[model samples]
Target: MPSRADPLWRHRPPALLWGLAALAVAVLLALNLGALGAVYRRAGPAAAVFGPADWAALRFTLLQATLSALISVALAIPVARALARRRFAGRRALVVLTGAPFILPTLVAVSGLLAVFGRGGLANQALGWAGLPTVSIYGLQGVLLAHVFFNLPLATRLILQGWSRVPAEHLRLAASLGFGRRAMWRHIEGPMLTRVVPGALAVVFLICLTSFAVALTLGGGPRATTLELAIYQAFLFDFDLGRAALLALVQAGLGIAALLALAGFTLPGMAMTGLDRDAPAAPGGMARLLDGIAIALVAAFLLLPLAMIVLRGAPHLAGLPASVWMATLQSLKVAALSVVLLAVFTAALALAAVWSRRAAPLLEGVGMSALVASPMVIGTGLFIMAFPFIAPARLALPVTALVNAAMALPFALRAVLPALHRAEADYARLSASLGLGVGAHLRLVLWPRLRRPAGFALGLGAALSMGDLGVIVLFAQTGGETLPMQLQRLMGAYRTQDAAGAALLLLVLSLAAFTLLERLIGGKEPRHAGT
Candidate 1:
């Protein structure tokens, strides 16, 4: 049933795509299962013994993740609704700024939070002036604050997409029919919320489940430890492979459960489109005032911590030690390697999924399977497997780059597949008719079409890798430190000025890498992708 408008290319899965898919899946399986198997082999009977501390860690992990998701989604609802219903100067800029947290390095963000909410920070200073009790930005409350800071904007953007999808005609009809606010909620917005909110909740929950750097930074003590942090303590302090492997399994199980909950729901993309226009039936008076307040509050919440980091860091930039500079060089190298790996893996998987309908689901699943395995688990397994071969510390940069790329693949693929599909739909047949081989077709057609999304994906990977403090901690030796690790060291040593300067330097470099790569290859405008 090829129509006149349809391209005349044969409708079959390309061998090249399948081969690439198979290769990618094999590597993924080998990395994940191999690591898990290594851990399992190392575990003893002690692995089965769940101590009081272990149970408490599990409870705290679940508690923090659940609260973070609920609070982030709850806060997002009002903000997203406000954004969807109102239009003002700088509206699009505000929306674009919402994406900043996704790329913001976790530890840098924690430093900002400390500057604003810590004992001597702004919140405490204000409270002291007002004769009020100061709040502590540590333990469970700090963790919640940080998670909400990272996720609320993401949840808002996702829900805003739901609002964007509500047809303009439907809003017009509701207006003509004189639907009240409650009626509009009942008939229109309610259903959209039901469809979108669960997925957003699930995605955020999954992310928080694997959180290590946040818990590592703000987790006050054993009472506040998450499963990932527990794994770290077990391996580093106790040198107990059995306990570490057991904790890794438990952490992996939690992640899998979250992923399963995400099943049957379409994973939302982070593309910022169709969200800038004013609502057709926007209310005035009180509604307008409320919307303004909501926007102003959310904007302040997002921007203040970042402002604090810059203000504090700017003064110490010239005084940073040589170690900080050295770490910056190492981080840049890792980020570059990570971006290269991400491009290769993402392109292969996305192309396979695009050209092979029969294997699309499998291909997509393999690309995202890294989500089921936490970085600590993967790092531990790699450490164990490599212990017999060479010193794990020597392999830190390469392994960090590899793990970062694997973690970033799902987001990269999500951005690339749509563009690939469009290219196939619009030009596949014409390219075939021209008898161009794969190289010619790719260079002339696919590269031009894929450049923007691919650049954005690579840029995102580079930024995330640049700020990463996860696996490197486990493998870092005397001299093998990345910028995030260096910052952590500065903070641990109570070098406040140096830490602030390093945090600022990390932030600037991360944002610069993201913008440079995205603009250099993606051209003027670039759309973001989600985790």
Candidate 2:
């Protein structure tokens, strides 16, 4: 995919700026790894990793992630098929709404899920009228329920993107072969599942494996703590970097092994398959009933929390004051700044992807850094590390922007890099003769070619920043607050009314901005897998 005018164009200055920058950031951040070798001081011995408590936490983390991934993917299949095949009104809206969680902060999402599924939730209240027993929404089941709530739609989008990729020729073949529902699935759907399942499962598993937010809020007792939560406890509660470093190593090792195993089966060619789309044949009564149930189940999981946010926030809308509006403006500024930072950083990552063989792993390693030491862990560590030389909170906005941008690098890479490579492949010569500078090239040549991907990347960046917690958690002790931090503050103070109102406002703004950015940046994506 290298081209004549692109940095890879050989007609050019190095297009490797992004790679160089990424490597620099990696080297800078990789400083944390040095902590591991600082003599485990009190670790007792290398074999001491199997502490009963640590072992239990590890066991429970694996159990929760495996169950969550299995359930999330299993539920996603039917939902994906319906979305891919059906063209009903609101279907597009539903598809977009499936991405809603990507923009919602984890803590905010926890609050919303608690509203609908917690003991005092709508379900219990309604069921109470029928004399049903109240359900507890804290523990392993609670963690998985929240996981499904957050991930099911995203999993659907990923798979449905694949399902929609089934080629037109394949549809023609299905018709010629007199393929019924069962036959169609065997021939077409099975292949789509094969392609989508591992990535979906691995992504969900990776997330759940290091799950800190869901576990912190909903994991009822010590028994349910995840590796991420344990890391937090070791650092904050125990002040033991020796233990934290060891746990971080253990987490990194497990995650790396899982990812490498998955890497062998995945290819660029394979990734595009399920999006080879086809118009499915209409089903009769049985299929309709099944589709309805599937749709309802998935929608319930995705929408109930959103509904709760709106319902809880609605009552306080009439009484909010001037400071709230000021806070909202501050959030917007942060969102805009965060989006710019994310765009630049993601562009660097995308450029890196185009230029080097090693780009993928470097970016992958950096992307997961946020997981190893989450907001509290990273924020706390950076705070400690910077204390002697400089004040960490003084750089809150920039740090928040940096951490947020780093976290979003992988998503942005996924969106922008592929199209950038394609565009370079398609138009290298013409661009070279035109002699465009990078800025002008972006305005005229690059933007048009990669408009869709840029929009997707930008939206993802903005959404992530808007809902960010990583740096903001520790940094924003100053008067200003990003939307997520403000929401967290409201929760901490038990100002539920104010938090609800703010959550509603933030939910709408973040989702709307993300959608707008996506629309603006969105260009034509390939319609079918084979296309």
Candidate 3:
């Protein structure tokens, strides 16, 4: 047993390690705020204020995000209910597949979207065959479509988790009462949606509000511009740091406001249980036909673009340029470093929050701030900070990795904190009663219990890092390209086949990294004493 004053105090609960972790987070925040402040001081108050153009961008951002949120949630309800009530072949696999888009790189998803929805793409071709007017996917409609594409599955998964929470006894009682679908929904599912939908809507809206690459690629014109895209244009294209800083401030304000608006609708924990248990199946009839159609349509909608990417890119895989390969290596390195950083940051903060009940919310709040702190905003601030001190372009890889870690921190924290809390609640007393030291308890108890969620967080962080394009765009120079940036260059140069191949490669890599990390870390379940 170690004394309170032991040299291993650093490993104990309520240790200074948590403080150090908090300090590191503070420094990261400070550097960005400091840069923003410096820009404000230099630019003056007038430069930071919004103009008519800026207001237009703000309006577009809100409108698209709002529409996207509503449509995603609306479409998700049937799909989620279908998934919840019906356990068919590959249903579990489909549930897992739903998570793929959330981690799929923005640019990669955009490429796939364009292949399916762009002018002269499959949808238009089909419409032409039908003698129907063609639709375009290069404006506000396109932006909203892409947002729904990415977020619909996420909304489904979240709502499906809520469905899983409907108490089995309550459901059984409904069945005993001869309740039909309408009654079940009225008494059981409707209330669950009331609890789940607002938070889901708010989350999806905030994510879309920070849209950058999707808008950049498909925005098509000024009318489609988002605040994030404006920030990128202000800094990269116009070299106007002051305007970029101002826009970043405005973006932050909107994000904070949106968060405050949604703050009352608490997000359900990501940790899921009892999924293996079967619920009372909804009676088969027209309901089954509707559910089947809903499931089929969603599967097609979610999977067709991916199929197109694969079909188109398969022929071009061998022709990928050396530059693309090099960029892939660079991306892997960045993602690896990002996973390490994110793991340390998330674990420390989560543990610290669990240890200090009074400061838990504040500590967790700091972690969640990454959600609203747009990557481009952070990158712009860091670029401004690094400009005078070093060649900002030279530090692109490291800065990108750091910003990627920061960007993924919020999700990682969400995945981890709940699991940590549950593990602590379940095992804390048992370990303490056994006189296990902090280090021993963590290694023997907490680590085993936490492996699943930790792996999930790490996988998500790695995938997001690998796919990130925001900060890298601000700092990348010759020879410093990431895979996403490299793919963008390929597309710019009319290397369509090559870009498609690279998109396929990136998609495969991102999914593989996420799958491998999650499985490898989340290994086989542990056996308990009796079992």
Candidate 4:
């Protein structure tokens, strides 16, 4: 507080920073509010009202999201606890593997699940051998399976973070008092869970609520439709713009309601002071056996589907159709463009947020606005706005990239802003003393620090755009298909072999894009001698 020359004391932001921030806000507003305006304009009086079908979609949306969240959290609790207390060979690798599902292409993961669980899959083969009735994977059960597969890792990681934050001293004290497992839970672990579980549940709920590709592929029957599927039906199939607009608004309401619910919880980012020491172990062979079983089961559950995908798709890879190749190219293009847009927009917003005190809140808010707006809502508005002047088909890839970038911006900003702040804190005085210009400072000082987070953010954006099946489904024409759309088309045509190959292709591309971008842009730091 006494320092006069602190970086925080710089009150006057540059004009360029203001301009970039304004542009970022403008883009968000155009995508969100502009879309809302178009939706309102097209929603004709009385004709746009909700009916029984719409209500059913709403009910199904809420029910599935709630169930998915609950089940994911329930399963995650044991897996996370196992990881926290147990030390074993390959444990670090196992923990790292938990992040795979988050960046994994959604449709690719779905295809893997299907390869293992579908009608003629290994599960049914085993069931038939056991003289039991085979299970169906085409309705609500399929949707739940897919959701749990995708979200279990996320919940596990979040809960594991809470475990990391717990005080090691508490465990030692409990051991000194000879507290049994039940007593230990009553005092320590249970209270930590109370703080962590709600946030994890809310996040998973929100993610499942806006699910499009999963519901589209697994649960699209009349009884299983989500609000997103309903919106797609209204807009594309029925050509009822009014109904689509109304449904878009309803989807927006659901998102807002979920956000409101989330506000009551203590998010996992909060910190607790802890002794910097290893946690004391509770002694029991039974407990060790249980923890080992938990880890093994969860690992098998996650990895088997991926293994099935590889086993099933390898031979078919050589025989994929030319259309699938074209779609792959389009997806790559979209992912590239999306990474660029996300980088530029995120950099602008992060710089503005760091450099300008007055605009920080508004800029951050604009960055995160995509959370409240569904892709379908933004796509619908863009469709309406362009219908008069341009064909929606022509703008398909560009619009997809833009919306993907916007959707990814908040996450990118989260990575970048902290890095930027750290850079400024560490180097501001040195750079000023050396009389370094803005460009030089950025190149020599800021770039090195920002590179890692920015690369990760770009990689994440690229992966997401590479595998997106949402807005592209709405706008793609027959010839202009992205990889995900083409894969869905293959599935629809009952070309299971081709679909499996294409899914494998998409998975490879998604993982490759993330790894290459992160490694290339976030270059490895060289180690110094005499450490």
For each candidate, give its TM-score against the true structure: 0.91, 0.86, 0.93, 0.91
Task: Single out the weakest 10-residue window by summed lDDT for candidate 2.
Answer: 34-43
TM match of model 3 to true structure: 0.93
- What tens digits encode model 4's per-residue C-alpha lDDT throughout 1-531? 524444432455567767877887998999988987887787656567789999999999889999999999999998999899988889988876666677778888888887778888788889999999999888789999999998999899889988877878788888999999899789888889988898889878878888888898899498899988888888778878788777777777777777677776665554566656777874669888898899998888788888887887899999999999999999998999999889889988888887776878889878877866778878988988898998899999999999999988867886788889888888977776676766677899999889988888999899888988888877889989999999988888989899989988988898899988988988875565522
Q: List candidate 2 stretches off by more than 4 Å.
A: 1-50, 267-280, 321-330, 357-376, 429-443, 478-481, 520-531
lDDT by residue (tens digit), candidate 1, 184-218: 99988887888889888988988898889999999
Q: What would the per-residue lDDT of candidate 2 be over residues 1-531, giving only the tens digit for each residue?
A: 655544433333254665555554664364344334431443445533547778888889889989998998899889987776666788877777766885677777888888988788887888898998888889998999988877887788888878666776677778877888889878777767777788888878776777777897799999889877887788768866666666767776777666775676654444433344454465658877788788877777788788889888889877765566766676677778868866766666565545455555675456545434344445555656566788766777766666666666667766777787777667655666678655565577767877787788788778767776655655666477676777777787888888888878778777877888888668445475543
lDDT (C-alpha, whole model) for all candidates: 0.86, 0.71, 0.83, 0.84
Error of 3 at 494 (Å): 1.3
As for candidate 4, its clashing pairs are none
Candidate 1 lDDT score relative to the true structure: 0.86
Backbone clashes under 3 angstroms, per model: 0, 17, 0, 0
What is the C-alpha lDDT profile of model 3 across 378-448, one tens digit per residue? 77777777888899988888888887887788888878887888888887767766777788878998898
Write down the lDDT that model 2 would get.
0.71
